[model samples]
Target: RVRLFLDVLAAVAHAHNRLILHRDLKPSNILVTAAGEVKLLDFGIAKLLHDATVPAAATEITKAAGRAFTLQYAAPEQLQDGDVTTATDVYALGVLLYVLLGGVHPTAAFTTAPLDQMRAVIEAEPKRLSDAVLLNSAGGAAAVKLKQARALRGDLDNIVARALKKAPTARYANAALLADDLRRYLNDEPVTARPDAIGYRSAKSLRRHRLGVAAGSVVVLALTVGIGAALWEANEARQQRVQAEGLIEFMLGDLRKKLQPVGRLDVLDAVGAQALAYYAAQDAGRLDADSLGRRARALHLIGEIAERRGSLDEALRVFQRAADSTAELMARYPQDGQRIFDHAQSVYWVGYMARQRGQVPDAEASFRKYQELAQQLTRLDPNKLDWRIETAYAAQNLGVVYLESSRSAQALKAFVETRDAWAGIVEARPEHGFELGNTWGWIAKAREALGEFDAALDAQRTKIDVLRKLPDADKNRIVQRHLAIAASELARLQLALGRYPLAGRAGQDAVDKFEVLVATDRANAEWLAQMTLARVILAEIQLALGERAAASASLDRVAADTVRLRSTDGTRNKWNITLLGSLLLHRLALAESPAPQRQDLEAYLATVESAVSGGKPLDAEQTRIASAVELALGDLLARDAQPAAARGHWQGAAERLQATADRGELPSMTLLAQARLRLGAKAGARSLAQRIEVSLYRHPAYAELRQRLAAAAGAAPGTP
Candidate 1:
């Protein structure tokens, strides 16, 4: 097979030049033709000299060779000087020949030696093939036979040695010359490979060639023997490896999937991930495209599983394999990117998974790739709103990642770019219209964080207006989601600006919408959570208005829903809900005016702290609430003379509240003012009290607080 492959290589080279130096020769890029011809490939990277023409078909120019090829096949001068000559190709060809005939390169286990060591081996000396036979000989006649081996009969080792000369000046100048030498030896002539040649120069050449052949041949034979022995024992072990792997994965799949319920949210994912990993390893070398597709599907399944489990690393690997498989499929059918997109959403998920793992670079790469795919879809069908929407979504999420990392400036830039890109998407194209609102909502949040409240209001109002403009008949689940988001943001803005009644109205409107959705879809966890959150906000406003009974009722509703959620789900998953509900309950207790309920407020606040410390996923609102609860609890504890605990909680609350104030997001003017007053920062308190007076006097929801402030105003004119 190798002999045939070499014939093909010679033919291929001849097509380009009388002597094309295929310098970077190795087994990896060489293939055996069916007729036993050697087919050489990757000549695009090979060196072409004076005799070689640049092919008309070649499109790009790259560097010529030296040690640019594999180090193992590199000729000594080529390694040292980046030299290019036909003899360099001849040297690499010799290495290839040694490997083809011997089952290994002419070295121990075919390990790549260093350049200097390899140079020494190729240049320093050579040993005769006859010397090797003589070393292995049993008697005198066999030793004599060993001495004349290449001369009396063609020795592949001797043929290789002459071609492998380290010094280009000493080597066969081209493949044709080496082939001629081998042919002469094969015909049993007084060959130039024999040490006792007719002429002095020929005799000297033959002696060196014969010596190198003998040394290289010894290494080859040892390798051949070891390989043969291993193959002889591998038949059963190979079958067992395959069988054992199959049985184990199958058993694991059975055990792992036993308790999983049908129609479970993660059903497709859990089964798929385990199956995909099993198949990918099992079919790495699989030739059948159908089999490879199945393996890819398994990987896709695994990706789905990982996404559901929030195992971003596992999901990324799975989705990458799916992409690879699709690429392979596309190689057989160029312009088949559409076919890959037709499969499950691996591309978007890969980007999402990358972001989840905090692999920002990887996430950006995946997102760019996804955008390229989306662009293809757009070009193929410009009316494809989903494609444009997906591209915009990727950009938005990336922007969110930036925002969360405190790169607000960068995030604003990204979101603005995304908004512009999506703006061309028609408003009638409902698939993407909701995203417009969502994008604007995020832009508003960014502006709000930057203390640009007017800009924030404009951004938020644009979202609300656009969403409200949609026809009532066109309004669906997504429309509701957008409305909820916009209303929530507006509520926050109003709350920030001391328009407590307006904030309460906006928050209540969002809650009303979510409540309607929850009534229709009982199991929609997000909607349920949002409804509960709205109640908490309303309860807070009511508490400020001194509508103690209404505030208590709202708190009661939040507690009931949160307790139900916590009872059904694991505490680990429901802690955020629990914390928010508990905080509201504490606020209700504090506002009750009755002395006994104050004890209940203290207990509720303690629970909020414990929930946070236990690693629950609390949002910024919940975090603020927890801080306030701790502060109030601390103040109560301090009044009772537990100075140490009171000091710790108050100090922590003050720090957190200060951060919020710094961001200009805190909703508490009066509480913050009083907090400053208690901490003896009278100047800060007085400033905060002026802001509190705006909320108290102008916000109808805090009319009672306004009255209290008026009385306090006379008692201490500038006091918090």
Candidate 2:
């Protein structure tokens, strides 16, 4: 029976790798030939997860004229969210396994009534397999039922129950993991479904070595008559475990907060090493639940320290291990709030590491699980501020993923939710000051992605204001870093709207903060990258203000830093677009002669255009930068008195910009309007400008875009 299940799992795992999901998996959909070959039959409702043709919100199959799922096998998430995820098929597989082993459907008792059946699928916990086997007479006889019950009473019971969990996050992540646990059980190995409890492991070992043990008179364990010595050894190990836990707690809880302001945590390297060595010395299977929990937490701190020190491979390895350990611990005590909370952090960290590695789909899955776990914790205790804060973090992380993927509308929704959650959290606990800045920053990023520059600027200002409210804002490294980032982002939005004066002020503020940080931490690659980015944007603001010498100086100062970052740290820090923009702007600043300089600009623009259009795939941010470079070349052509050619470039750039949805870039829009005017479409230009003015109404930064719009209205065609 397990072999048949494994065959089905292989097919499902293959589909998942191709980003396909079988939304309606059931017995009728799977078939076995008379020759005992397995076949997966139906894919009428299969959902393609990664297809560009499919709408992001339409990942689930349409019921069309009726419901699609076999009510007995539908996962709770599938019923509730109408989403087809990998977990949906795993749930169906679990139901199939349950029926094959226990000879009855797990939901048979309460799912008789049609109305109640849907509710049971969505809300009711399925009956335990052991209990169901005794109650149902689907097997040959009462003796057969009892025999099946005995077989599935322990690890098998846990494995099936985990797959049938009401929350998709609580279930096996995929069919492959579910099959792995079953395989482990068959091979007499410790199955992941159960925690590494001593008694369970000892029983398994005894089963595998019973004859050998009987030959040796219960092996060495029974022959040893010194209970006092065993007690002493146990006591010594308990002492060591307690000491390790205390050390880990201090490092993770209090020391971590302190070190955030101090610098990279090289000081804690020895401490992390000690904790790891202590845990490694013990046999994990013999550790109690508390010791396992301690080990899990220690691994998390070690991963964090490794991440801080720029050891990404080690960090991800430790984080994944911690996550797996925490999952097992949570499985052992599914209802414990502390266990649930610990598991949530582990899931989140694993997702964070995956995102850092650019494995976005894996990150999204882990983040979704983190969100589910957070929601579960919230339901477990609505008034618990810690759990509520975790929910906010969950929303924030999901918004980050959506923003990274260029799903701006969905990202904005998630960021707004995160901001609202933080708002409520701040009102309840004013001491959670750091979150105030970060939440608004996320909202700013989401709005920026949607081309709502005015709204994004407002959010950035709020972030700066809240960051400044920290008691140690000036002295604290983290607070100052956030303040600088907020200010730098504010400057970019201001520049995007053509607000020169405000952009200069914001940009200078960011530069001032960054200069201080860089001076103190010259060896820090991440800080150096961030500081360079601030200067690059500052230079762009300088160019817009026509401060030629200042812009040139700033660009020169950051040129080496930009090169170093792009070569060494680009993948980790992700400021490639801004740095590329800085390079283009610098070239624009130096292009004084018409013919000679125009060739350089044209060639550079062609290269950028090709890169964005088809040469290499880019994230939305880099693609927008390429579009901006096209417009810059048009400006140069217009300045050199090539009116017709300038208009052609401007028209092409305008359409490209529109496709990229970067209408918030006021200079690009100005060029677009001018191009339309040159083409004798005055009304079209006026209408576009009017629509923008309306969209940007009531924002304080609205004046910048409005002024640009007015200039476009007054300008003659081909005027640079």
Candidate 3:
């Protein structure tokens, strides 16, 4: 059964490497297959890092601190919104182990209380094992069976208690450590489990000795002289056993009160490393492959934390070492395919993180090998939504690679295929609502790229509605995302028809929502860039309303912020550059001076045109930037007397911008109409103008746009 659990732990650890959080883990979720192997099941409430919905701002409201897992097995922070680091999983695993050995829940003996209530009791003080034994002997239903609890040969009670520590920082740093302590207890070596206090241990030891003496005295009537000797020996043996239990319990308790959380807990500073090292060294020669695999997982988690903190090089090395170590362990124990699969995943993670540095080839090769290993996982018959998702994910990422390499046609195919695969996964597994939302959202983007606006809108709407159906408590970023997409789509359609105010309001809503996110944390490069672009669009529409001063203020702010964020890391932060260029172009178009402004704006516009046409995953904010830049470029060219080129640019910009249905598209369309009128194409210009009128009337941002288009239609050709 312990081996079955060890296998389950390895599988769970592998899932964690992929950023899946198993919110429910207990004895029932752990099962033994017919082949005598353990299978971990039930990710019904798991949280995936790669969600489909547009992410929202991180607020205290969305924290997953307390509420998912069973209270009897939940970590302390899992009671409140404290720090629910991965160590919480380790705590739950310990509870599972306790139940497997003792035949009853550790906290269950105390009360069938809520997690918060249990956590308070765990933190306050623990009932002594001797007292628990006394309670059991007294026929108390509230107490666990002493004989059954003693199934664990040495220091088991203290081991369980330590792992169930209320504070995450005070528990085993991770599952690996908890397992190590368990192994030590099994081996009759010293463990970290401790009593509530030394005084408690002494009192318990004395009580046990007195009990042994009393038992021994029952046989004293037959041989008075030898009875004294028998009683003394019994008391001595009892004292030795009690002292060993006390010592082991104290050691475990001390360690539990100081372990790091599952991730690279920096607060432990060097203590985490030292404590882990101590455990590793204690049974270095005795570790089986399962033990080694668990260690590798712990090391992998540490690497991830380091990577998140910007120490990429350190993370790379750590992941490399862990992968190597796990590989060797798997080679020695070929039967443990699950752990070996996990080792392959750790190597793939190292490659995935490397992609962020623009190392395309290395990342590609890594994912390719990862795909091969993950394919084998399909045959393993993983519980559900198993390793196949990893294969699909690898495909999606590879497709992103093609997109980045200027292969839009190929990129489009990959994204579509990936989207389909995800859809199938969601369909087959509807319980993973988050995954369903994400797959649907990406599919909408793909449909939009294929010029299927209605389909795209439907897809987006589906994503939003799915999120809305979820409880507000579980909505998190999805709710805000629904609103953001709604505002963006509404603005786009309204602008296409010349509804300036409606378009303006819709765009302004997106800007306002994003701005609140930006104020919380400017450190997120992506969010900062997005906030800037949103502000630029809002300003552009404001200017179109003839609010020149307000528009100028918004543009000035965008320019200032983007300029500061500009650096050599431009490729990765390309959206920042796009925002900068678009802001400059908008400023030039509305500038009091004409000559110098036109030159600067034209240069930026040319660069953006090259980039977009060359095939990039057009980020939403950057897409808006490109649209505005092209619009300004066409207007400037027409005003400067380049009629043919002006007409060509305007026609192209108008058609492309119309695809977005953005409110800004209307102004560009009007400009295109003016260019056609100048080129002596009266019928063509009127046709385009009529289409704009009809489109505006149908838009949610329609009322303001109807007036603008109606007045434009009444005006003569070539009139301002």
Candidate 4:
């Protein structure tokens, strides 16, 4: 099969060299005869790149550039009507090899709908061949076996991934390069097509030299025994060394290989526990530095397992122990670069886990330590790119802490430095596009918090552009979620800038993307939550346009989904509580509209008040929702001709909004101004209102509020 794939690549190389592109290079295009000779059979859709003259039969192919392509095999650029190139053929070959090796189509998720299948081909990344093989292998003994699954995990997976890179420039330049790498793999030489991770290289080295290491150990053991009683103790020491080596080898080699393909963390947990037990049984005083290092690694793995299982407390304990062990090792081996790096990573993980658990003060202290360690590592090895990246990441995490603590200026400085550092790294290695995109997203948020709206918008657009260029794949859920968030945020900025149509379009696009994701995985609460937020944004846009019915419908769906999710989980999801609050606010708007439903308005008002009175300390988002609900209820009361009651509700809304505004939230400032204006506090209202953009008052829903504010200020109704 390897030889056949090589032959196919050679054929592709030949075609590509002659400026020919075989657009449809699937399995059907290749044939194996009875004598096992490989043949390239089809060129039906092949195009001559250098020649402008087209044959009568090839006319159809030229016309079908965008409209006619195999859905499963088409490259993203081709699907998007971009220029086709040799890389397009490389993408097709990737699909072919993936199916041949993994026994499944890459875009299997969209098989039911032709249009969706095309979209998947255009937007989604194929699963790793090893993962596909493992999934297929789960269909019982009769299913196809990937005997080479372990071997193909890293290098082969990388080669295929490079070939299938969404950006044409990122793939192998031509088929010859891919074929040469395949030949190198066949010759038992190290391939240049894998990620340069230390762990991957270490595992590969162990796999390659296992037998030789075993033989060498035997020779050393035999030679030691020949020295008789004098070396008997030395022999015992050597035996202990061998046992430790075996345990480390088993943990890093076979255990990782077995568990990685299936992502079976439970099995990994058992293996990690056993290794920790072995370390525990050893006499602490007699254990060497090497044994301590191994113990540290085992504890780190156990901590990782606990973290994956959502046992944050246990993860923290084990991770701290791992850090302490590594710190001891570092103290013993102060000049060891590897030990230093390991200790730094352990410390970083401690900080990361602390942050996840919302131990803010602890998280800040740990992250400061992490930053110090990373800075030291970078200084120790100035040319080391990985250490520099780590430093940037540490800074970024610190920035996140600052941002969450509402220290906008400090967060902006940290984010700026992190962005610049990552920009340089990305310039040096464009393959780090995903990380670059994430940095931009962080920068965008920081800029937004600093009220640099124009810069924030630019950063967001850059984030969106970077994410769009990334290959859409199941493994890239983080990237997809970020893209959705950027889009939603863009909509908000656009709305703030008074670009209603663009905001509406962006909001709708966000909703559509999240809907597709939710459809793909209905049980994913994160995606569902994002979808609910997207709907809220869409409803806001609709309300701005005075499309009350559409806004109400959108809110209704959000409310229904929130209710279902809460019921399904058998707990009150706090995010759902926030969503419910938003729904009630929007429902109040709908019920108090021109065709007012007085009963429904009162019901929604009661619900909002009941939720707020439940005695729970609300987060910033929940507080905003509660305040919006209060303002909506006040508006309803004013419209009902109960002036004194309306003033009381408005006063309460003003207090909530004022409290929220004091937290440095922009939207709350505007709402507080409106609330004060409604309560006839014109002097205070004008002072607060000066901070708000006039574009907000231009929205139809805010028109009445604007008029009242103008009236209170003793200005004409149409005056700004």
Candidate 5:
């Protein structure tokens, strides 16, 4: 469907480049040959856009033809007898794309009275292609229908939405630009239509934010002047090894503190290169211990720079070298705990890189080894604050790996241990509240993964409370970021728990804070990107509260911001997933019809399954989200006309959650009970529900599941 649209788009764009507008674009006029070629027919009613050289080639055709274009495919301008331009063709193409992908007209549905057709064309917004597809396919044959809607949900939906803007000036400028966006979507690249770039914009933003001056003024000027001056000073006297070393150290250390914040990564890259080169030429065998130590530190700094630049491969290589150096140093000074600490740090970074790249075994191995070193450090000095905190960090990182890999029970246990460790630190030191806040955030995530929604909400609130304790926290950048993250999390948890008012407050708070961060550092594109995500969350909350217009406006505003953010986003997956997630939520919310008795769960399921199955398999977070949708689908099916169909979806939810249940996660255990109960395995459901009754799960539903199971087991004949 998309390829065919692209083919037609190419033909139209070609005509557009020649100053021709296909004023009437629709499926009938777009013919596809058996040979897979596109033939755009009927430029008979097409207009020639104004050109000074060709006075005869004018859009006076719209006046002469008197709305001669097909009414269903006509743009708002044509329906209103307004000036026709390239945007008219863009709008028609949008309708054509809608028909091709969704198998429905974009605007014809609103004009059942026929006489109101012009009002529908000139003012009524069209149903999003995704929604239209599901609604059109509501007559059964669901799998294929669901698939089509899913395919049109995200970027395709955004593209269509842009093209169908009511105001001509708001639609795509021309067919070529629209085609370019479509091409970007097909290539799995960021589309200009709905851009939230993952890299280029971020570096640009960071450069401006880090430096008071323009990005080029600081980055380019610093690279040339610093590199030239350093090389000149060092080469002027080759014997000045100590002086050269001092100069390099200043660049990496004190000077780095000043320059690094300016976001001129090139300066550090150049300095690191020179420092590494200098050390590479030196005779390590003859070097004093202090010089050797400095060399190791230099490698650590360089590796960190590599990490910050998202060059994890380079970082891992450099960190390994540093670890080797630290290993040799530890051998020389076996009693020096600091040397052990240094090696441990290097190992931790290596593990982090491995985890990020999805090398699970390597990440686990490194984290285990890192945990061992952290333990040894604490054992050597049980009273040391830093060593104990290191131990906590190691455990926390291990929990992240376990959680990501679906070991929820272990992840929860590890996070709880880390939380306790941080809590103890805060109790004794009082100054360590920040680390406690961090631990609580992780705990919230683990709880959520296990389906302990109520507990997750509590943990998230606890995390926010911890962040709120810092003196003048709102004025502190680090605290502000933590608060924003925590508030965003709280908003999501509250929304899941059906606590809209609280969700709204937290969501609004998160959006406000992130916006403030954007203002504080205008060059920091990340802040803006983060703000967009926060706004999406807020919009979801608004939708839940039935503030549809406000929710829609927020989404509309965010659509324009995403383009710039994707460029600066380090790992584009998060922003892309967030955007897609927003679409899914919006579709689900709107799919709730005014039927009074039930939501359009089939539509909801179609949308959810579509999103989860569209491209790459859903990640863990998305899979969890899809599981929730499945559970809802099952719930509806159990009481609906076709009760037996509920079994498959319930079983799916149970099967997906079983891994966590097997690991003894209480929330998953309760969820499994619900699924088992719905599946008519009364004894098994009761057993599972009883097992979770002892947990500290705050929600009454935990115990309610047991009661429901018991009641169902003792019910009237033939309940299943």
Candidate 6:
């Protein structure tokens, strides 16, 4: 089975390398003939990445290709008409692997009806392989025997689950990586698919050594029976002590030192389950303080694993139990600081899970409790730097919840405290550059929310400087992405400050960085998407600086890349493509100013209308893009003397700009004023303009519009 799966993966990997998507991958498509050889068959619905004859638009391609896939074997993306990337093939392979090992399909429950099966493929999470195997085997000849089931329980379960992740980005990057993990499992090496947890490894080790332990127990029991009652009781107590010591030794010495460095937390979960089972089997009256503590710690570890896997309801239940257990331990051992800390940590996770589930009031209450606990811990150990850091983290988490609830003032106060705490930590440990950088980012976000652009810009610059000093490597993709994001933010702040030259430089730097990333990993759709966005930012800066040709070039590149992406993957890039196409049309209108063609104006307006009609909720950045498109269409229509059409577009743009301004975005306020002035509402325009600083009158992007408003208000040209 392993060799056959590996062969299938190799074929999938080859297809991905050629930028080809095997839209239908299933067990039936794989053949094993007489000589124990594996072969992959049937690429009837495969997609070519750069087929010259195929159109660039995904809708056109889909219409031509139609939907031809085996429902049971197809990936969620295939069913939903999403982009069919290499990850889609990985998902199908995961289902195949699941069925091979478990003796039943993971989605068997929903297979009775076609619509139910479709919903299952798109929305349902499959059962873990271990559970599926047990349920399917049930009193019959087990799938691959009982021993194979045991081996598949932990490492194989995690590997299959990862491949079957709902989001394509969350799945294995390609089939080769999935095969590599399987190879590791077959070689008895630690797999990367599972979380690195000491407890889980300990459990596996215990299971492997169970026969030896049982033999020892049998011998001890015989010896105890031969001895008298008093000696027998003493021997039994000593035996229990030995067993507990052995479990602890295996967990800490063998598992922790070995697996923790490799980051295998899923293994720890196995150990934790074994430990919990051991404790549960013991008489409650017989369990000592140490045994109770171990039980609580085991539960905590299991809860953490559940939380990481996004099983929030299960995590909450487990965390609460752990917290209760720890609380009981803390009461018994009043001076045990570790117990107090563990109790607080468990409670904090409970609150975090509540927040994630959107139980706002419950989340607020739990976070407050967590904060109080952390504060108490800090007070008890005033000089403990770890406790102080924990307090700061608690504040930060609380602040995030407050921010989500729109309590900006409270969030800002919490963020300031977090920043101050991290600043002290950085001063004490000069090597804590990453933590310091993150704190600066948090501080900048809070300041920006309060409309303090100057302070936010300074904070953002500090973050960028700190991030730039970090070493760049393939493993540091996250840090590199952060650096790009910081540069983008700096460009936005500079633009808001009316520093056009600085904005252009910052935007171009961001684009350069993203371009490098895309070059390094050309198959990464996410990096490509980000590169497109960086170009969009650069185009915005160019347009604002009156560099029409440069803006057009930037926008043209975005349109071209988006088209290729759509052709390669399907409609996943549709939103971005539509957005870029509209912007390009708008730029062309600007370039042909004084005689902007009516056809071009109508085309631009149609594209913008299509984007709006998509009806998906837009983020602030997307809303700004839509507003800019509207504003451009209005400008073109007005220039062409289409009064009614122009007024409608201007009104739409003004509403969007106003909505953004209401969120305390100062840059949007200026744009709203400009929109009002264009609509001949001089008094309303003047009212909005009065809120901005007079120095902003020098900004070239809106200087003429401001001058026009000034003329209408009977003020001198260029006056604020």
lDDT of each: 0.57, 0.70, 0.56, 0.69, 0.70, 0.67
Q: Flag regions of model 3 displaced more than 4 Å.
A: 1-100, 103-171, 174-370, 382-384, 399-431, 473-475, 478-505, 518-522, 536-550, 567-573, 592-720
Report the Cα lDDT for candidate 3: 0.56
Error of 5 at 282 (Å): 6.6
Encode model 5's per-residue lDDT on 1-720: one tens digit a residue.
677677887788677655677787877887888998899888787766555565553535446764778777778888777888777888988887887677777877634665577777765667777888888944357787788778778899888987887766556667766786788688664453542233323433344455543446667767655655565444334324433553455456544554544555466778887777887787766664545565677788887776555455677787787777777766777656677787788888888877644456678899999999899888888887878989999999999888877777788999999988888888788878888888888888888877787788888888888888887886777688888988998887777665779889999999888877666544444456667778888887887687987887787667677655544432333444445445444545554443212254455445445544543234455444555567767766666766767778888988877776786665567677777777778888877765665444433235457567657867643221
Question: Which of the numbered candidates is closest to the native, going by highest TM-score?
Answer: 2
What residue pairs clash in candidate 2, if any at all?
A: none
Displacement of the residue 289 alpha carbon in candidate 3, Å: 7.0
Ranking by lDDT: 2, 5, 4, 6, 1, 3
What TM-score would every model get versus the actual structure? 0.48, 0.55, 0.49, 0.54, 0.49, 0.45
Candidate 3 per-residue lDDT, tens place, 1-720, comes to 566566766666555545556766877787878997767787766655444462654322234423566666666576664555546777787667665655445555536556545655355444433334434444345434554445543476676666666555546555555665666665544565554454343433444465555566555523543544555455444334333323233223332222322222343335435534643453434554534555565566656545534445566776776777667765775545465577677768777665644455666677777777666666665643656677677666666555444334555676667667766786777655555555556556555443445675677677667756655613354355445655665455444444778778888887777766554433444455656666766776777678887888788788777765564234432533366666666676467443335566566666665655543334433454555566566667878888677766656655554534333234444444544554455676666667665432332223333343445568633322
lDDT score, candidate 4 = 0.69
lDDT, candidate 4, 495-536, per-residue tens: 766678888999988888777656554544556777888888
TM-score of 3: 0.49
Please write out the lDDT profile of model 6 over residues 466-520, one tens digit for every residue. Answer: 8767655234665677677778777867776678899999999888888766655
Q: Model 3 misses residue 536 by how many Å?
A: 4.2
Candidate 4 residue pairs in clash (backbone atoms < 3 Å) = 125-472
Tell me which of candidates 1 and 3 scores higher on TM-score. 3
Distance (Å) between predicted and true CA of 518, model 1?
1.7
- Candidate 1: what lDDT? 0.57
